[model samples]
Target chain A: MRNELNRVVMRFPSKSINEGLARSGAAAFASQLDPTLDELGDIRTAVSEAVTNAIVHGYKDEIGEVIMTMKLFEGDEIEIVISDKGCGIPDIDQARQPLYTTGGAERSGMGFTIMESFMDSLKIKSAEGKGTTVTMRKRLNTRRYR
Target chain B: MKLIHDMKGGLLTVRLEGELDHHCAMDITARICELIDALLPPRVRLDCSKMPFTDSSGIAVVMRSARAAQGIDSRFTVAGLCAQPMKVLRAAGVDRLVEIEEEVHI
Candidate 1:
């Protein structure tokens, strides 16, 4: 939030189907920077993971709202934060581990890994019984975007 | 998202278009499992070239398909993955497990 040049905030219900909505909304807002196809794809994937985490783990079976905030900073850096007021992660370190999935079966537990790989920085904050927030930042190598 | 299944020479290829996310993965997973169980093709191929975007849920789709194929003891291959699908598949080290018909360099 510090030294932010531009920003967008949106909130939606914690439904499984809203995963696509959140991803596309973030990608559409990022498109103003004219990011490359690969860059856009990375942004899309990262948002999808964050929103999915909110819906799948944060809310579990209950219904809630997911708040998404996007900020554009100098040097063409784009930052995104997905937050939820649902059950928070009890073990942040363990949950962030690659292949560590609380959602059994096909989850693959690669959500954070994919977000970390695609974005420049990924920060997770949570308090048990409170909520969890995930913030990701990436500097769009802006030469082409400019 | 839309899914199409085609059978040729005993090989069943599933072509996916549009975005694949948690929204549609459930039905896609069920359809994939059903197809594989019923047809029991010698080989199954997933076409991702036309896909615009895919996420971790898409990974679940692929895994479910692989499991379904395994249930029938059939070979499975992923073909024409580009952009998003390609990046995700590589990072999950899925290439180490499933066969990619086209070379996808991470």
Candidate 2:
């Protein structure tokens, strides 16, 4: 949200298959910061989690669009935002708790958990019936968590 | 996602390569189940050395795989995991139930 450095925005259908595209594209873009392999992998997994949530929880097999944006700050900081115009979470606190999932059978409920663990910062904004947005940030030059 | 399997009587070694996410978890699970049904390996080990990335869906598929093997009275283990997937599996609490081989690097 600071002074614009460089960014990429893309909108795609809320489909399961597009998750890979969203993740890989974001990883490729974030490579500009010269992130380590582990850092890149974490970023990829985090992006995948957010996009998958938009498709499974937000859209829920309904036709919708998931918008993603990646931006770079001057100090080796990268920010990613994934948004969806679909059903919003009524209880974000419960949703953030590990193993809390609406899709009981298939979902692991670790979507937000993984995103939170891998990224340095995570923020979620949502309104019932309006939409949800997940924003995560990380500094590439920081020491690796591993 | 690609799955390489070594079906030798009662032991099945499945090496999964590529990124496992929501996009391919279901299909991969189905395929692995198909092989399990046909081979009937008493012990199934998943080698994740080549699988560089995974998400919550990966956890789901792995848990399902573990359940599938248990349903057949077989042992299911995450044979090897690199750094990233290992961190995810541990955070998901899968390390408690599923047997994972240590010493795998990122």
State the iRMSD of every prediction, in order shown.
1.3, 1.1
Evaluate candidate 2 and give its CAPRI docking class based on DockQ: medium
Candidate maximizing DockQ: 2
What is the C-alpha lDDT profile of model 1 across B5-98, one tens digit per residue?
A: 8888889988888888877888888888888888989988988877878888778888879978988889998888876797898899888888
Model 2 Cα lDDT, one tens digit per residue, A29-58: 988767788889889989999999999889
Candidate 1 CAPRI assessment class: medium
User: Deviation in angstroms for B49 in model 2?
Assistant: 2.3
| Alpha carbon deviation, residue B54, candidate 1 (Å) | 1.0
**Candidate 2 local lDDT, B1-106, one digit each (tens):** 8999887767888889988888888788887888778887899888888898888888998998888888889998886688888888988889998888764322
Candidate 2 error regions (>4 Å): A142-146, B103-106
Q: What is the DockQ of each candidate?
A: 0.70, 0.75
User: Which regions of candidate 1 deviate over 4 angstroms?
Assistant: A144-146, B103-106
